[model samples]
Target: GQAASSLGSDGSGYGLAKALKHSVTCIVPALVQLKVKAHPFAKASGVRTEAKVTALIDGKEAASDTGEVQITAYGISGIPVFQISRFIALGLHQKKRSEVLLDLLPEYSEDEVYRLLVKMGDKRDDLTAKGWLTGIFNQKLVPRILEMAGVRIQTRVSELRKSQLQAVAKKCKRIILPIQDTNGFENAQVCAGGVRTKEVCPRTMESLRTKGVYITGELLDVDGICGGFNLQWAWATGCIAGKASVMRKKK
Candidate 1:
């Protein structure tokens, strides 16, 4: 109540979605790529090269192929399983605690999960179910208690895999993970390695592999790191391609 009162009438809510949209708009084209030289200075050279990193813009290759260039990656934004489950349970149990438990109890429609919880009687809170026949796993009961068995059985009635849970965690759009080359295509900021640029006419940006098709954006093999160059490339190439598509004989 004190915290709510302190908030006053306007409320302090940040427009995350809006901020993201603006950021994406700014970053879509000028993407930057970080590259590290494997060996800045060979031992034979007798002097270290300082091992500096170069920011490669999309479309343009590294200035020097002299060194081994590697793309850098960032860590994923993932919530731990225990913390996620705790918060989920808290939100679900917010109003009328006992009634919430009763509501959740019926959610475990499967005979096995239902029977397990009923057999445990008053210790039903130790188990959680989400309906459907999936799988049952063992879990330790919360709170330090003696006489009560420490081992408790847990069954997730929802048929969701670990990958699915991770996907769901990202769906909320609140979590942010660094875009990396090793991450799944779904989690990537922009996809790389599409229609080979060699198969496309540099003058027209039209595909030679599949004539009449003009490729642009992340769909092309061209990708940049984190600047607006990608967007600039897209616009420049798209403009030329668009003009090429409707080329007419000089009359």
Candidate 2:
């Protein structure tokens, strides 16, 4: 966000500029990084879960991830979401329709979900429609799911109709949200593309096509997920390039 811009993402891109001048080829990844944004679907935020999340481009599943899914004010973020974010970014880059489907009750079968909802709906208690699913989902998500199922929060769970329970079951298994855009480079963990790797000597980090010039860090066509490899690559290559420059100067 604001923090990223302050870190000198001023958009001058001097590294890529220099690479361009040197005529080094660069293969940009389909995306840099993404914690995608989407149109508002849920009435609440701060929802988190570990389940199956799939990114669909043009109504087809391109990528899916499972682990943690964090619901942000803008859309979604997390390692699992991040895993499939490339497809989201790629689809958007190509102007294709992009959507993300969440299986809130992934571990349970559709029939199991329906049976559970029916069981909960029959229970008479202080639990309102909002809290009916509290035993099944995060408290914040309960209302969101009910809202998606077209139920009022104040409605009593015991009064839930069979059709309403079925709708809830369907939503529990599949919640499709239309993606709008990603949080952009500023929020990305690491850029996916840079100068082509083959253009530089691996050991010296010096440009093979343009001697006396060196490339390092994001300037090289290398990127890693959330692992420290991205930072390590930047550090290691920068050190190699620095040493190569020193040696040339001494000669």
The number of the candidate with the highest TM-score is 2
Candidate 2 CA-lDDT value: 0.72
Q: Each model's C-alpha lDDT? A: 0.31, 0.72
| Per-residue alpha-carbon lDDT of candidate 2 for residues 49-71, written as tens digits (9 for 90 to 100) | 88798889999999887787777
Misplaced by over 4 Å in model 1 are 1-183, 248-251
The residue-level lDDT of candidate 2 at 139 comes to 80
Among all windows of 10 consecutive residues in model 2, the one with the lowest summed lDDT is: 24-33
**In angstroms, how far off is 215's CA in candidate 1?**
1.6
lDDT accuracy of residue 117 in candidate 1: 37
After superposing candidate 2 on the true structure, give the runs of residues whose Cα lies further than 4 Å from its correct spot: 1-3, 14-38, 122-128, 154-163, 243-251
Tell me the lDDT of model 1 at 206.
72
* Residue clash pairs of candidate 2: none
Candidate 1, residues 1-251, lDDT tens digits: the string is: 00122234111111221222211111121112221123111122321111122112232212211122221222111112111122222222332111000011222433544345334333334333322111221111111010012221243323334443333222211111112222222233443334456666898877665566666554455655334665787788889887888882231
